[model samples]
Target chain A: MSILVEISENLQRGKAKVVKELVQQAIDQGIPVEQILNEGLLSGMSIIGEKFKNNEVYVPEVLVAARAMNQGTQLLKPLMAAAGVKAVGKVCIGTVQGDLHDIGKNLVKMMLEGKGLEVVDLGTDVSAETFVNTAIEQNCQIICCSALLTTTMNVMEDVVKKATEAGIRDKVTIMIGGAPVSDDYCKKIGADIYTSDAASAADAAVNVCS
Target chain B: MIWTREQYIAHCNFEFTGREMFCELFGPLLQLEEEWRQQGASEKEIAMTAFDWDYVLKTGLPCRTGAVTGLKPIILEDTPDHTLSIDNMGRKSLLHKKAATIPLPLEYPVKTADDWLKIKHWYTFDESRIDYGAIESRKALRDKGYLTLFSFPGGFDEPRQLLGEEELCIAYYEDPELIQDMLETMADTAIKVMERVCDKVPLDNLCVHEDLAGKSGPLIGPAQVNEFVAPYYKKVWEAAKSFGAKIFSQDSDGNIEPVIDAFYDAGVNLFYPFEPAAGMDMVKTKQKYGKKFCIKGGIDKHVLRKEKEDIRKELEYKICDITKGGGTIFALDHRIPNGVSIENYRYYVNLGREMLGLPPIQGEGWQRMAF
Candidate 1:
């Protein structure tokens, strides 16, 4: 098997040390930095993302695999920057205002990064104005909002309204996901997208950008 | 009409014994107490009794010098905006005062086996913690027609909350022995505490709080629950049963359908706040489980936020069938939210009573969860 395949397998297994070593060996083999990043590290995470969406794996498994991906990505960053390989899309994400829950938002952020999308996470309890402003300022293609409470999920409507008011409504795709958020809610609020879980959210974000 | 003592007791025993409400919604009710009274609602104080766990165990651990099985929460700092405190679960948090929600956890106390061992001594059997005088006073109040319930914050919820969800889940994989040790120790603590209380206190019911589910399903799956949670519950129910405890119920939020059978098997006959939004349907659950399991709180709470037609439709859909099932309690699936206006709540309550064949409460409706 190729060294790239080994790196992907080790990353999936959450073998961080083995991933780092294999990533270095691939670099020694003079493979393109983008190939190692896209085919090796990212491919592993994308497979895990599919597994997660399928319920073949769960939160803990997703979390550890993300950790392995992070470790390998850290090693590749400097080289990838030198090669001038840009991300497929720029996305800004956060939990909506008055909602302090971060688990869902964090998972979505990780999955987006795993899909080779550059993600700017604004963390939890972010206001509608901030979500719109950050997306515009950062030139992000997508803005994702998360909420855990039925009460707080109403804030997503404000996010949609504010994005429209800011005149960036056409430029950015607003994606909302959480326990209370449904496709009907997304349609009701006039947001661009609503995916049930993080993996699907990343995939949809990628599709929106394309 | 004034309710007789037996009628009230039956309400508390067989029907709902109030519900856990959000402080935001509860705050306004306190202001309208007098208005409710003028509307013919009865006000009664229920006496709660329990052996002081700290005084009994006498662990003398950390800041705590007594039998309380929980951590000796210390106020590390306080400010108008936030209060940084180490709570009883041994998790340090900076509580945001304005939001009235829990503070962010800065650190968890028990991460390893040694941490569990350090806390283990706090739950030892302490005879001195048993307050006979206190037990007698509560029993006398019960005799005088006051509702009395022996509530114990159980093992699974507290342990998981204290340990932090991610850390505990990691510990389940990395250190199964450590997780088992903590749970078994906590179970023993609960058994010991209840055993001592039962020896002296005569209570109406044994209520255990375990918020273990979420909107999707049980936070921990059935297999994990069977391994870690079920045994502890079995021990608790068996212990309470031996004490002649008549009613054994548990309060949990979210869709608990996943673990409902496991809970029933472990002797939890009653479950509360069957949150409809979380996919808990009173009629279907009643059908599947039959009359063996008692259910509380299945009314769609969101109806109050909508129009009166919505409220009527939701109640008419859920109430008649659930009430006929014999063990179903007529209450909102969860606490009334702040979105529910006093008028809407009053209407909901009056409608519920009308469906149950009880007289309508006067203007403003009843405040407490009473007959």
Candidate 2:
């Protein structure tokens, strides 16, 4: 019956309206914004993320849970800003060039955002230079690339090369993922990380950013 | 030597499904036709060439129905530039000009049971259009010695596409009846169209295009598939068979391992273009369901871009074992993209022939029968 647990449970159930109401109530009760964010919304989302990674839940569950998280995040954003609190990390993500598939990329973006990360969604068919330049320009701590096709997965290599050329290769962790991408391909491309699913990608992004 | 139709059919166990060559790539295929003629290759010598219902079907129902209802697919946007448009299926999609193969669906028309009811009205078969002449036209193709393969929309892919994947997946739990209603509507239209086609001409084979999987596996898990897709498939398959459908198959893009058995039991005896990138293993699949179900595509299309030897190695594994008893067909898991040079494709095809103890196709790049 604890306030945070209630928020977490409501968020997990994808009762976005309920989660938002509880968050506002908790705020009125003088609960710390950071605690509500980390313990309530993000905690619920992290569980959903793990379940998604484990294949116990699928995309729709993750999407609705993330929606609830977003509802709670919106109510807390003004307070967090007023309190001088900041997002955990900033990252840039996109589907690689020649690959127009964005469902996987969008899923990863939502998961990262649910984890309290500021994600700059570069969208699908993004060039390697866009990813590299955006990372440098935005001071992103990580560059995440996704590709759904084997033919376009090589574009991830170009992204790594672009980051290296931009001279932020060491500063920004490069994460590659999608159906055809593998750990071997990640290593071959010299990317820092590769995760099979969106949740793991988000989990890795958090680690890389921190 | 040119092979006879019976020998070719026996060699591959009637595993041939027609091509889905991109609209743009049709030019290249036509050009290849001229080159093929110059090289002394007869019409029958070209295995990929075929005339089928997908190209001629008037009512786009059961196969890409966006254009069938007399609605021109308004190009809401142009491609390679995130061209957004409402496709023929009353679904909004972000289509790319370069990759015109599959569009990313953004909005779906049917989500709730109410939505399903409204959309069901759009799936009407025009009896005037479905007259005996429709079958007569196809029968003419069959009379020309071309094997007549017919296809209709499998109930699942059409409704899933109409409802978008996310909504459809969630609807399985939230509105299972809505899913059933939409599927039943789809089967109704399919049975009517297919019955007309079957009543007119003997169907040599049937392909139900269901791109219902991601790279990993079925978008919806096996249980949902059994509950939602299986019965609809059984209904359509039985209707198609009653008229005279010899070979039945499902044309899905991604790994279908979860629903492979379910599809086989539903009378879809063949699964085509088994995408290797999606973890579809021909060797393993054949080892398990080879006797009951035949497979068509397993060669990873990406391998064709690699060195010739790499392409050979990719084909070598499946050529002998899978195709030993005419239970498998040699094809890219999906369409051969423009990225795959004509030379590579010709090489792959000739290599398949060489392995099958058939004569190799002789040509060079941009030359007769080459890229």
Candidate 3:
């Protein structure tokens, strides 16, 4: 197999240290940085994401693969910056107010970064005002809200309403997901999208950003 | 005839305890109690008739079951709506003080082998950790038909509490030694502590709790279960089983359907609060496992937020054959969320009990779980 395929396989198996070493080797061999990133790192993570959605792999596997991808990508950051390769889009994400749970939120953030988008993690218990202000100031194309509580999920609507009032509703896409979030609820709250799992959420965000 | 907590467990194991029984593994959200009071319930009425909680009695034996016993969280910051605290285990979390939601974990206790070594001292079995007086009282209660449970952190859950979710999963692959040490220390600690408890009184239910699954399935699969969990779990569980823990039970949330065999193979004969939204069906599970295993919760908890007719429909379909078939303790899949009002909740309990042919409730729906 090719060196790029080797890096992808190692990453999928969660061999972070090995993936880093192999990525550096590929870099030294004069492979294009974007090719190494797209073929070596993101390609592996994309497969993990698909596996995660289909239950072929689970949280642990997905998390480690994400970690490995991050490891491989860390080596390419400077080179990519020199080459002026830009991210597809930027997004801001958080768990909504009164809901402190963040496992799902963090997973989606990693998947977003895996999809070559810059994600500003606002952390948990984020209010609607903060989400809107952050998106406005950061010039993000998408805002993602997550809540794990039935009580706290109502805050997603406030986020939607705030974006509308702030006049960014038309400018930025809104994404929502968590244990209690649904496509029907997303529509009811006037949010743009709701995907069931992290991979699908990343895929949806890519769609919105593009 | 009324039966001991032991007998109730026995009946669920297909051992036939004179009569079939109706019980639950959990209670209302307790945060919803304030709302219940606002909905015209007197404080006295609420206390006396706490959804008939004791009617289908399952009393957990007051033994020290946490990673480290008797350590309260140290307050670091106090806001009007949230609190930032470091738990005794040295994990930092942000709490939504008013809402009573699970605190968002900001930092975990263990990150590396050195971190595990720094904290390993806390896992030892100390005499002070055992609650002797509470154990004596609950032990007496157990013999008098209250199902007494000897509950502890499951092998997977113990390490997860120390390592946090993300690190724990990665540690299973990258730092196998750290995971093994954590699991081994916990298993040894469990055995030593449980031996002392069993010497005082026999345990009816050996309850291992691991909130290890999600809407998708278990965080770790059967392969991980066999690799990281089962070997140590088997040691502690078998010791409890040998010590007269009639039912080896586990409590996990979200689609545990996939890993039931891993748990069963490790000697768990009973499970609780099987989430329906996550695809756990009582009828299908019964068809598969028959009466060999016991299931406590499967009724859709989300349905309680809806109208009475919806609640009735959910119950009628889920419980028609579950209760009569044996090896079952009827309950909602999880706690009652705050969205469910007192009136709707009472209707659920009363209507649920009536459907199971259990005793009905008193006026104003302040009755307990038992008749």
**Every candidate's TM-score, chain A alone:** 0.98, 0.96, 0.97
**TM-score for each of the candidates:** 0.77, 0.78, 0.91
Q: What share of the true interface contacts does each candidate keep?
A: 0.08, 0.16, 0.52
lDDT of 3 by residue, A102-207 (tens): 7889889988988889999999889999999999999999999998777788999999999999999999999998876778789999999988788889999899
In candidate 1, list every pair of residues with a backbone clash: B53-B67, B53-B68, B54-B66, B54-B67, B54-B68, B55-B67, B56-B126, B56-B129, B57-B67, B297-B333
- Model 3: lDDT equals 0.79
DockQ for the candidate 1 complex? 0.29
Give the candidate number with the greatest DockQ.
3
lDDT of 3 by residue, B1-371 (tens): 23456667666687655444544445556467777788986675445344543233667656675667346889899888788888776678878876665776687777779978987878767877677777788777766777666776677888878888878888888889898887788777788878888777776778788878877677888878888888877988888888887787787887787788888888888887788866788778988888768887788888898899999998888776645646876777876677787788778877877877666644322222211
Give me the candidate number with maximum lDDT.
3
- Candidate 3 error regions (>4 Å): A82-84, B1-3, B15-25, B42-62, B69-73, B101-105, B131-139, B362-371
The 10-residue segment with the lowest total lDDT in model 2 chain B: B51-60
Superposed by TM-score, candidate 3 places the C-alpha of residue A71 at a distance from the truth, in angstroms, of: 1.7
Considering just the first chain, candidate 2 attains a TM-score of 0.96
